[model samples]
Target: PNDALYFGFGKPPILVPKSNAIKRSYSLTWPEEVVGALVFLGSLLAVRGVYALVPFLMALGCAAVTTFLTLKMWRLIRARELSFYRFNLKSAGKLRKAGWAFAIFACCWIGLNAHSGWIRYHEVLGNFAFQKIQVPDELALAQVNPARWLNSTQRENILEGKKHYDAASRVALFVNSEALPKLAWFEYLLGNAEQSIQLLGQAASYQKDESKALSLYYRGAILNRLGRHEEARSSLDQALAERDDLILARQEKGESLWQLGRRDEAVAVWTDAVRRNARLALVNNELAGAARSLGKLEEASAHEKQADQFTPNDPFYQWMLGRRLQALGMSELAEKHLRQAEQLGAGDGMPNER
Candidate 1:
């Protein structure tokens, strides 16, 4: 009879006066619904970017909150029979259901965070791998002194850079746009001007703004040297457009203009170039020669002195000063400078004063 009463399998043996038993319905309250929705939304937002730590932190926070809520739900389940526990079995079931929902949500959140973290880890690893590839120091030294680069027999170092460049190309995440430009310079030192121009163009295509301007500047200078004045001028114009303060491009553009017989335009360009960079010895020398040809002897003398001040040890500058002094009838000073020029290996007669 006790088992029947407890299990509700049959009617009780004794009956007493009945009291009213309140019936209650349990559902999600507004506060609980809002909290659950916020957690779900936050988990989705956490994995939105490339940063790995953000998602990991979000997962940790969610897991902590979910664990706390789950423990509370477990305690409520355990005390369901206690008088102090006002919630019925149906309410306990709802709490358990909510706890499970939070656990599943946390697991999903953690999984997304882990996937993002893995991708970020690979990105970092790829960067480290790229840094580990040894680049030859001579590659940088070569930029300062092409003659020294050409005279160097460090074939192994050059080969190493080439090997690394190839390896970097194979990796999807590696980004070294300057690599081809450096290689182009090496090829230029090797007397491969055509290949250098091609490589520089490739490098420029991969770059933007100032870097692209610099690559174009080099291409223009090389083209100017090769007597391709039109193409050189076009490249230089593009470079100057990209970076108006690129004094080297301005100087090279002037040279290209002079080569194409636009003397007045060339002089105007150099005037602007020198105005921007007064210490530019090459422009000063060019302006000096131009002034002398136009019979502006005083102006020529002034520019020649400026060039001497800027680059006293340059063989070409010594030769230009010697020529200017010779024209001015300062025979002794001209002879001294000419001798110095010869000693310093000014063997190309004159550098066109460009």
Candidate 2:
């Protein structure tokens, strides 16, 4: 693969972000609109009648604009466009059509409206229902190893044992939690969430102990992906309760709460997690994510800053710094860190979206 055209991104359908740092921001900020609405309504009912709908409404309007822009930009990215990265402005007109400026605007908006909507939609439905989510009937989408398609990254578990089946079983027993988040990631690719969940559920049952945490967490994610928040939360809760202080479980639990329209609770969880463990990029990322969800870009940036403070050399932290800077419209600063992030080699776990 030629480094120039290939851009060194791994295989297709895996979807590991060139940088995982963007994912953290993407996951956390998307809730700003809907979560902000919930926050506004929640706050309006509290204390003196000093309403906060101003923030809510402002957040919503911004969310709408950002949403339109994001959809438009997605089209551009899909078409292998986004001309701003070019060295010269010779094709500015064509570039503008790709909505690069709008993409920047949407990224800078940092409301996290997309993720928030998913979180809220799933949380409300799942929590209110208090039932296990139904896995999508389709299995192909559930089995995608988004990271595996990328040739550079290693599987969370390198399968090696007496026989092929034994190796697979061993790997399954001690699979990488970072390998994939949801069965639906595959489902998304395989074009079937239902089957993926069943396969994952079956796989999850085969694992145990700490490994069970990963299985349960991922299964919960599948539930979330399946739009089954309460059940997802239940499974996420099991992961956290079992681990007591597992960072990923904690992050997912907070994510579950955020999705369920429990922004305050989500914030509380991240706040507690951040206070308890400041060095974790995942924790800081989620906290920053929550801050962004509240239309608190400054707070979000600060959280990202704090994340880097604890781990100055961590590539993930650097990637977060770059992502936040990029989200804030500091393109020069963003690129510098983005390039640095590429050098650091963070585990984005996404395949080549292109």
Candidate 3:
């Protein structure tokens, strides 16, 4: 029930328009906050799948909003130095004050976005949002940074107290199942796809209370990654039978279908995921990917533009925006997004494209 209402990706960011532009009745775009909400929804169309995908859209959203407002404030401050534009340090320093606002905004915004990733076991899905949901105090645990795996003593403390809890009856016994895949994914980043597949296999065995649908869904994902399309499709179809909302399973199935040269079928699979998770921009991105593959550049651009409405400032957002423009044959605008994306940090938390 909790998962049903708050089921979108983490909350989309909040955008407060800087007062410098308009104090009156004229409006061009939606208010920044409204746009942020939509962007968040668009990014989360994959819904829970975002968790498995290395926190991409949320990070992208953060980058976009930060870059745009930061630049806007920067310009506002400099506006004073110009003669007619005028530098009267008498300025309330609201422009400079924006730094404080953004600082708080970024922290709160990113914290909410990153909280699930950082503390998946801590709060049960909407435990933070809806007050009525009761979460056990024990559930407030944080993640162990794999880079700094717990020392034996710390690990002993956690396992000693929590080890005996009744996970056998848990709906999410497969929850920790994510840990090994994440480890393997990092290894995959370092060029070990085979080893990553092996790790995911191992993780699959630990799942205790998994539904057949979920089991097949995860297995399908692994098989697809391993290039075993026929098997992946079988598993995906089974998962879909149980829960039509399994976006990742459907996504993997589509990938497998595409690899099998069933282009139309692949598109159909993705289109369903997009419709189910309308908030996830990545689904739309996947749509764009399919369009590009079909040589429908204009169509790809349209979908990508919708993605841009969410994250307008980040360099990567700019880069993606530029790519969409290029698809539409707009060389200059495309170049701008490309250049900005290059300037921002693309490598941060990003998996190797290979």
> How much does each candidate deviate from the true structure in C-alpha RMSD?
15.3, 32.6, 28.0
What lDDT score belongs to each candidate, Candidate 1 first? 0.62, 0.50, 0.51
Q: Candidate 3: where are CA atoms >4 Å away?
A: 1-212, 310-341, 346-354
lDDT, model 2, position 74? 51
* Candidate with the larger lDDT of 1 and 2: 1
How do all models score by TM-score?
0.51, 0.39, 0.37
Candidate 2 minimal-lDDT segment of 10 residues: 153-162
Comparing 1 and 3 by TM-score, which wins? Answer: 1
Per-residue lDDT tens digits for candidate 2, residues 170-258, read 33323323222233233333334555556556555655567667767767755665557788788888877667767656665675677
lDDT of 2 at 333: 46
Give the TM-score ranking, best first: 1, 2, 3
Looking at model 3, residue 195 earns an lDDT score of 62
Give the alpha carbon lDDT tens digit for every residue of 1-354 in model 1: 555645446545354325533456655556656665664554444343333224456655654565445434444555433222443332433544444554466566456545544444444443443344333322222122233332234444444554544543454243446566766765665456787788888888888899899999988877765668899899999899989999989988987787788989989999999999999876787788778778889998898789778877756556655654453334555566678778898776433221
Residue 97, model 2: lDDT of 34
Task: List the pairs of residues colliding in candidate 1.
Answer: none
Tens-place lDDT per residue, model 3, 54-145, is: 36566565556544444344444554431112332214444334445544565565444444333443322322222222221111111111
